[model samples]
Target: MATPAADLANWIPRLLATWRAARRTQRRGGPRPPLDALLPDELREVAAAVTRLSTGLTRERELAGARYLDDERLLGAYLLFYWPISYLQARGVLSELPRLPRTVLDLGSGPGPLAFAALDAGAVAVTACDRAKQALTAARDLARLAGARLTTRDWNPTQGTPLASLTGGTPPDLITLGHVINELWKGEGAEEKRAALLESAARALAPGGSLVVIEPALRDTSRGLLRVRDLLVSRGFAVRAPCLFRGACPALLKESDWCHAERAIDPPPLVAQIGKAAGLRKEAVKMSYLVLAPPGEPWAAPPPGVVLRIVSEPLAGKGRLRYMGCGPDGRKGLALQEKHVGDANRRFETLKRGDVVALEGTEPRGDGLALGAGSRVTVLAEAGRPVPMPVDGQA
Candidate 1:
């Protein structure tokens, strides 16, 4: 199977060719502006609209009817700008899984970006569901052009249909909800609707299967996903990534903070232009995501005795590097200072949030954990690992 990056490299050029051809045909016999020339201003407008939708400042229904969705130029700008971000996000989530899924069901799959990602990740068959016919049509066209094994369905989860029923009797090995929960939050009975949708997705998961949900890293959306995390735990699903414990979320306990992850992505040329025009930062993509498997199902687990999973970016101070993380016990902080560890500081400095590390000789500090100079700090997993660490310090 091809890696997501390879698959994206092949798919993007074809989509661009199609988009350009469509543009030329739309303006046949007229002086048509260069796609690059028209992209910056159009991308700025789409970026602002996307921000509004993600922040709940504007409703999806209104945005759907607005020119952003209705106008072809704006829609094209959005697809081009968002394609790499979505692909990178999907690659990040799929990399944590123990193995490639045989089948995938992508819910609320706008333009089927994630479905394509799953296909690239070795899912033999992918089913994409969305409410918008136009989005489905675009997905179908892209899938056809790419010769990918994709099927499309027009269904709205808000209508109370069981997701499993839509997939026939064959349960999917992986289910993805990408940026869909935030839109669901806007309707009446949002809580009930979200719970029902999740429950259905869980029920539809095959044994040893996983359900992954991704949302914007905004305060509200991230907090909302935290709530979803707690709800899934309560329903007996085991979290598989970005969390070291199944206990209560530490970030949610705080009023002003939320748990989210960030990864750097190299934007495509047009996306870079749009970022410059809109003053948007294109270096890092931040999001809140959860991966859950049914209880008793086998998936990747952290190395033994590696209790704390760094959940925040490493904070570098004058002489020490501080890590805020979660453990099976609860939320804890750890500090690795240069003066104490000497040359070992270089190794510890390489550690980032989401890496699992064991503090060999540490004791509890105020709301955090402390490591002494004599302590052996070993990285158990750079991200999430399925294998155990060596007992000796040599690893």
Candidate 2:
């Protein structure tokens, strides 16, 4: 449903303007800042801070609960580099919503990447809530620069009022937690707290609304999200997208395996430069996410026949092409022998992770469904493409 940075191409200039205005270092009457501000020196500084911030958030785990975003350099680093990543990530997930959200509430909205992304994706009213005052200020700055209307509030679940306080009397059509829940509680029963918060939000959601939770794709975080998903599922809640299985997640059976999706992206020039200088890859964005429906909303029925989401990248062997797919039947391997790749099933030769595909023909081979001469391949949804719901068809 969402292609990539192209959907947000106009965001490039507005973000540059906001960052440039914040720096306030341009000489009087000097040339305006280019869309891709190739300020090598500034890029180096931002990249160095990006390297530190990235490490602290991903590897070192020291800044999990800290106010690192308050640091001028660190915030700048996030604005130029990580903001685009989160923005694109949100768009990818937003593409899967059953309906476009008219009202959105983004919790832990650091400098408002996801909140603003919601606005760009067509949300009419959005409230960006975060405890970091400095971050909220930046959100305002970005909003002003873009000439876009946004609501900013200070709300930290750890300290502030209950989650219900932020919603006022009217429930939001969409509530988003972008890389926020993992930062809360950090100790025993963290997963429970995360699930509890999401459940509350789901219950409070407007009818036909969605509650989206996006987390880091790190193995531990991904598994933690799966555990939370299981908890919510056990309580009789249903998922809107990404889970064809109605039961506890099958990916968690193996300790080493986790679920995450990679969507193609072409980083803006400065983002690529900063990433290169920081020793990171910026070609694509990756995250583990859940799209949960409000209470009483049932899971969209799966398409007819054998259908599964390609969970793993193509696992090609000497004579076969294989992928792990998770569907209503639970997770299973899908294999097609090289000799069996014909006109009908030749589409299997090019398969990407996150693609929802249907398989027909052939008996079971090793660990999955195999394809043979009679087999026909149909791609119900490509990576990042939205799946059809019952509202659209037979689901």
Candidate 3:
């Protein structure tokens, strides 16, 4: 009972084989020695057309093969590697640089894969850009699957000044060039082209932000992962990779590609509803400790000797919570419960980018100052003076 549609689909492979055979014949004996050996421009149009078709076909298959990826946890593991790699690189840069990145920008973001992943993981927003309109459309569709917002652009990195326009008015916390660097470098004046691309990336980088380049680990060192690593290092990035970072890069791969697509399915309506609410709202405020006021006034107790600044603000509906303290490097530090001597639920949103606040009740740790991610603050400071802090709005 198979319809003509199904019948034609079954015959696709044979048709493709026949077409490829004709193409091979033309390349091998019809004036050209070999398809790849020909001058680059000779195959530009054909290559681009093939690339578009391939991408379109792949998407169609992914949509059709949804059932296959549904039960695949292995695919999730491999997809997770990209984020950790980005985090490690960003952290490595921060160790040597003065500022920390506040945003992540993913370029050549295929299907908005890494961009949306970042948003789910931690980034405030994900800007997914690509040269192909079709690719951007696919990426936007993918973003819809997650109920997340994405800003997409049509851009080809190889030609035109579109990169400059795309990045205008805003600098990115991190610039990611995944799999596209090699293709961009294939034309004439490859070095100049690469430098031009890097210069653009460098210009768009926020203070202390990193430019991430990841390519296939192919034999062509000049056009593969090795080249990307070297190029980034030469641009003054503190390079850290599986090859460089000792045991830092874990194998995110599994037996099959299933690991990467496990999360592709839409969650149940109830679960999705709850998740959407969670995604829409600000996270719960975590109070380090409750500072008790003596009788009439809450300010009776003298402020602690050393007060930390408030790196984050409180939630809109909650006023009893407040986060205070800056890391030794001026980066925000989370106010932990173990360090607070007062009531629980006093710690507000983990300290964010700005806000000069302090804590009271506990003593400062070591040299009366804490450094690094998990620092302790005995007292939380306030902005200018300890006026009543405003409640945060529902995010």
What C-alpha lDDT values do all the predictions have? 0.71, 0.85, 0.38
The regions of model 1 sitting more than 4 angstroms off are: 1-3, 18-25, 29-74, 187-189, 295-302, 384-395
Error of 3 at 148 (Å): 0.6
TM-score rank, highest first?
2, 1, 3
Candidate 3 off by > 4 Å: 1-102, 221-225, 228-395
Best by lDDT: 2
Evaluate candidate 1 by giving its C-alpha RMSD to the native, one decimal. 4.3
Q: After superposition, how far is residue 335 of candidate 2 from its true place, in Å?
A: 0.8
TM-score of candidate 1 versus the correct structure, residues matched by position: 0.86
Per-residue lDDT of candidate 1, residues 1-395 (tens digit): 66555566676665555455545334436565453434444455646644554333223345532324334554465466666677778878888886678889999887788888888878998999977666676778888788887899877776765686668889899999887877774645665667667767877888878888988787877887888778777776677777767677878888898988777667666567656665666787778888887555533444566467778887888988888878777788888777778553345677776777776777777978777676677776676343242322443
Worst 10 residues of 2 by lDDT: 24-33
Show the lowest summed lDDT stretch of 10 residues, model 1.
Answer: 386-395
TM-score of 3: 0.37
Best by TM-score: 2
lDDT, candidate 1, equals 0.71
**Each prediction's TM-score against the native?**
0.86, 0.94, 0.37
